[model samples]
Target: MLICQLSDLHIRPAGQRYQGVADSNRMLGDAVRHVQALDVRPDLVVLTGDLVDHGHPDEYAYARELLAALTIPYLVMPGNHDDRDRLRAAFADHAYLPATGPLHYCIDTYPVRLVALDSTVPGQHHGALDAAGLSWLKATLAQDTVKPTIVMLHHPPFVSGIPYMDAYRFLDAAPLAEVVGAFRNIEAVLCGHVHRPMFRRWAGTVVCACPSTTTEIALRLAPDAKPASFMGPPACMLHRWDPAEGLVSHISYIGDFEGPYDFY
Candidate 1:
């Protein structure tokens, strides 16, 4: 099974740019096209969060239009910048999503089980998994311990060294880690929020954070480093799962690059 992960799209209304600078909508469109053109098409695609800039109805509408280009199955969750209610309403046809409360669900139709968690705390820039969410996760993971599973959430459950980004890190990570650590079958914990690709060993498994389709948050480790972002080469993650090899992930960058030269 191949899973494509696209994060932090931050799509804006048609003809508008994110933060009045980055052409996020265009970038997302390019990403969609790139995924479609991949030599080995993915079986599923997961959009971790921040699907839109302001979570407005228009933005979601445009986002849907852009996403409609995808021919493969896909799932989405909310981020801090997203309005849960609006996002739910926008993709109401996605029956997996609950009608109310946190948008958490498990997909068991594929070779790999997917447990998606809603980590966004409405009206805030940080993320947290409430008691109810943690309980749901614990129960969900308990259902099938043998299947290879991937747990996905918007906020990475570890402190990134980048001080500015760490400020908005997952708030309730301790308990969340405890719950995830108990499960040995989990292949990985996938996340978005950070806007740059990052990896860490956490909860007895690897946590992979996908890069955004928009701006790349500046990697500044200084304690007093000012928050900044750059319109760098955008990218997405492709996780290839083989029964024998487990799950191996690779970064697929968007846009044209000089390549295909044979080394002899």
Candidate 2:
């Protein structure tokens, strides 16, 4: 199964727009075009979150326009910048979107079972999976372990060793980890919202955090610097799942570029 993962567009509504420092809309546009031009069309597109710069109704409205350009099916979850109610009202017809009011969802299609969980904590930069979400996750994992599963969410369940980000990361990973530990079929835990691609392990499964299609978080691997935002190139992830090979995540830069040199 081929999966296209894009996150952290951080778009704003047309009228209530903000500065174009990130030129997020353009980056997202490039991503859409790239996906459309893919040699092998992806079976699914999973957007992990922060769909807007602010969780305004207008912002959601604008976000609605951009995502509608995708030729394949996609699902989005809430992030620190999203308002659950506003997101639902915007994408009322999305099939994989949950009806439970929170922006969490899942799907079993083709050779992969994709689960998108909500880790957003209202009005906060950090993330969490509450009791209800944890229960739902456990049930989902139980029903299908034989099938290759790729769980999607917006927060990293582990520390990236970046001090500021670690502070505002997923606070409760124990429960999630406990359940993840039990399911070996979980090929990967795909996420975003960190705005920089990061990798880690959770309960024996690989966790891949896709970079943002908007601005990126500056690498402050330091212990004292405040969270820094950068003008680094926007990016996304392309995931390929083969029964024999499991899963592989690849990062793609979507804007203008110039490179072909081999470091190897």
Candidate 3:
């Protein structure tokens, strides 16, 4: 199965720009078009959150319209910037979304079971999964030990070298890691709050954090690296799972690029 992971769209109201410069909506539209034009389209697309800038009704409405260009099916979870009620109401037609509580659930239609967890803490920039959320995750993973499972959420359970983002990393990650570590069938933990493409080996699984379809977080490594963002190439992560290969992830930059011409 091939799954495309897109994150941190940060869509704003139509004709508006995020941070006064980045055209998030246009970038997302380009991303959608790029995904649609892929030689081999993904079977499913998992949007790991920050779908809008303000989580306003207008933003969500415009975001929905932009994403509607996608011919392939997609699923979305919320991020710190999103408002739960507005997000759920925006995607209400999607049956996978739970009617109440956190926007957490499972997608079992494909060969791999996507277990989406809500890690956003209301009214906060940081992330956490409460006891009830962790319990739900544990129970869900225990449901089918033999099935290949991927845990999807908005926050990275582990800290990235980027100090600014690390401060806002998932606060209760230990408990979530504990549950994931105990599960053998867990293939990977996919997430996207960092706004950059990153991967780490954790909890006996690969934790893959996807890049944004809008601007990217600057790759600063020093202890006091300034907090900032840059308009690097927009991109998404493509995850392909096979029985023999397990799971392999590749970064796919949006828009056109130099040709894949044959080597002379």
Task: Name the top lDDT candidate.
Answer: 1
lDDT string for model 3 (1-264, tens) is: 899999999999999999889999999989898888878889999999899988899999999999988989999999999998889999999988999989999988899999999888889999999889889999899889999999999999887889999999997688888999999998899999998988899999899999999889998989999999999689999999999889989999997778889995
RMSD of model 1, in Å? 0.8
For candidate 3, give the lDDT of residue 248: 89
Quality of model 1 by C-alpha lDDT: 0.95
- Candidate 2 lDDT tens digits, 136-201: 999988997788888888889999878888888888899999988898899999888788999987
Ranking of candidates on TM-score, top first: 1, 3, 2
Candidate 2 ranges beyond 4 A from true positions: 15-20, 259-264
The 10 consecutive residues of candidate 3 with the worst lDDT sum are 255-264
Stretches of candidate 3 off by over 4 Å are none
As for lDDT, the candidate ahead, 1 or 3, is 1
* TM-score of every candidate: 0.99, 0.93, 0.98
In order, candidate lDDTs are 0.95, 0.83, 0.92
Name the better of 2 and 3 by TM-score. 3
Highest TM-score against the true fold, candidate: 1
Residue-level lDDT tens digits of model 1 in 1-264: 999999999999999999999999999999999999999999999999999989899999999999999999999999999999999999999999999999999999999999999999888999999899999999999999999999999998888989988889897699999999999999999999999999999999999999999999999998999999999679999999999999999999999987778985
Q: What stretches of model 1 exceed 4 Å from their correct place?
A: none
